[model samples]
Target: MESQLQQLVRHTRVHEIVGDVIRVHATGVALGDLAEVQNTDDEISLARVIALDRNLASLQVFAGGKGLSTDATVRFLGRPLDVVYSPNILGRIFRGSGEPMDGGPDLSTEPRVKVGGPTVNPVMRVMPTKMIETGIPMIDLFNCLVESQKIPIFSIAGEPHSELLARIGFQANADVLVFGGLGLIFDDYYFFRTAFEEHGVFARTVMFVNQASDPLVERLLVPDMALAVAEKFAVEENKRVLVLLTDMTAYADAMKEIGVAQERIPAVRGYMGDLYTQLAQRYEKACDFKGAGSVTILTVTTMPGDDVTHPVPDNTGYITEGQFYLHGGIIDPFGSLSRLKQHVIGKATREDHSQIMNAMVRLYSEAVEAQRKQAMAFELSPFDQKLLRFGTLFRERFMDIRISMPVTEALDLCWKTLAECFEPQELLMKQALVEKYFPKDVGPVAVNEAPIHG
Candidate 1:
């Protein structure tokens, strides 16, 4: 039964078509409202109102506008776009359109929740104090991933950013994982699915994927759908949710393409001026709800041509908590940072965690300088030799992305690595911590020793 309002707002007059966007002379249309566009052949495609100008509305068709006629009927649904949410969605894979991609049972009848809503109230959010361990020494030991923190891994092409994301997805201590892949190739998509299934974490994971061949509008929806489900799990089910998004650069590009189609004025580097606002809206979804579980977001923002000043990463830096700079197949300790780490470094972790992190990074800085001097063929010193040896061991043992271990075990190994090269007094750490944690029976580490395991 069509209400009087719906009947009054229906129009069979699409004035213009540009790419996947259509402009219609329809009144009483609201931004973000979902509409059904019925073509001349009676085929209905979903569209969402993107912009409105007195009695004129612009809609971006979800299923591309290849065959959409100018006279297609546009009927607004009087509501916003939504995604289905329920426990049954676990272990299931969904397309960016929120349809089931896996060959499984239908979920169309499940409960649906509106996405892209306002962020959680500031009063309802608690201070982030809990740590989410990823079992990666570079992350867990040095740059701690605090619960409810929103962060990104900044990398360029040819880096193993996806591999690092998958490792954290399977190994991070979280109750549910929601993965959103934007503009992924078939091979990259397959790798994430296979990694989750083989590692036995798929049962607790939900995937929203938009492949390179999919419609551009769908790419923008992937993050919203993933975050919507994660918010439900956190507030309703009281579960700690971790949302992982890869290649947000793709998402921002989709917005640029759509904005160009709409003939809107482009901002910096041909991107929309609202790029920061859009990214912040999604990243701010990460929160620790008071008296409920938390939602933490970790994203991959690839810098084109390794340009840090690129619009996507430059705007993201201001919106996110911090970033993990992945370069040369390893997480660079000097480039990566976790701003909220201060909240949990000593409170939620071991007593020696704070001192150990500072001491090791300080020593590694000196080691880097020593290597530079050696490269220039400068005068050799005994301390410089020791620093060189420590640098080699540090890279081999801790900097490798493949190395995974609990924070405690990694901290212990840090002490051993230090003791192998430098004396106890040389470590400018607290005398008490040094006396307590310094390796007592220090000996040469075997070259064939197995890498640390989680």
Candidate 2:
């Protein structure tokens, strides 16, 4: 398909091969440009230019470099890597290399769009004032996920972060969901697909998966591929898009491995110096277009050894708006925070939402202290006893990750939890909210009364 001049530019002198990377002395090659490596057997493989020094260009072959010989013919495509972007992509599963893997249909003829584009301009972005409710009480009641907000779920291995994320995917109030799974095993990959299908959201979802056995270069492309498709849906189709990426630590590890292969000097913890910038580039893709729809990013960032100071979570904490601390199979109220929740706490939600949230969290904090006192065998005051009761009700009703309810229902339940353990006047909340929302029939019950189960 190439013109004679284009064919003349093909270079056949690959000088070095390192892991999945190969070096060749070539001109007119730009970073990120696509290339075609044709072996002597005429077997062709795709590659992308990763680095350029003088006349020597380094590329990471997509199929890998194991079978590639130094005499392979390299032809620069003069374009960056791109992914298919179309409504046809919905309900489809793609590999990290942008190839269709769902066995549904061929997307080779679909229109393609370049990945890793620049972030939306500030002037074109709308302020994040709208709330995107996920039926989870912990998030909806305390830390609201706002439209166009970028946040991460901070967790460690052995946690049910994937389950929580899948719950949000099916329950979140979004028109489309884009999921990127980095270094997932077959079981996790199957779990996500089956969850979405069973929940009837698979038709509106697109999945990009990079399993543990996939090439490392593909792992680096999953985020960009997912974000690119999400932006297209938000901007062109005018649809609210929620992008979910799990185990970004694996993505970071791929970058570290590629850097080592390139012989680049390591920064902190052996990660590249541009670690923050690379993360921000993808996260900044979350934006509410002024006249169109929005993109919200929720990712899972596993902390190595549960250490917050680990380079991945530490850098992420700086780039993201806030974090949902997932620990002990529940969202920890003490550590979880949503900085943009203030934007919609009262304006978009009910009038009593703010007061109820504050009072409940304050009571829960006291309940934690009361627990310590009881654990130490200290004499408990009646108020401490009340705090202890409120804490139990709080965990069963709201803290449990399995509980799902609407914002209004959760607010009403909050009042009931308060009234069950404390007098209305003792709430220290706005007097009018107490009068309106406090359960009318429920009075202070005997401490020995049976607790309500969620």
Q: Give TM-scores for every candidate, taking all chains together and pairing residue i with residue i.
A: 0.96, 0.96
Worst 10 residues of 2 by lDDT: 445-454
- How many clashes in each candidate? 0, 0
Best by lDDT: 1
In the range 1-454, model 1's lDDT, one tens digit per residue, is 4565765457657899999999988776689988999999999999999999898889999899999998788888878889989999999999998999999888989999998899999999999999999999999989999999999999999999999999999999999999999999999999999999999999999999999999889899999999999999999999999999998999999999999999999999999999999999999999999999999999999999899999999999999999999988999999999999999998888899999899888888888888777778899698877777777788888988889999999989999998998899888889999999999899654343222111
Assess each prediction's global lDDT (C-alpha) against the native: 0.92, 0.91
lDDT of 2 by residue, 1-454 (tens): 3564464357657899999999988876678988888988899988888889998889998888888888888988778999999999999999999998979888889999999878999999988999999999999999999999999999999999999999999999999999999999999999999999999999999999999998889999999999999999999999999999998899899999999989999999999998999999999999999999999999999999999999999999999999999988899988999999999999999999999889989988988888888878999999999988888878878987889999999998898888889988788989987888889888664554232221
What lDDT is reached at residue 325 by model 1?
Answer: 96
Candidate 1 lDDT score relative to the true structure:
0.92
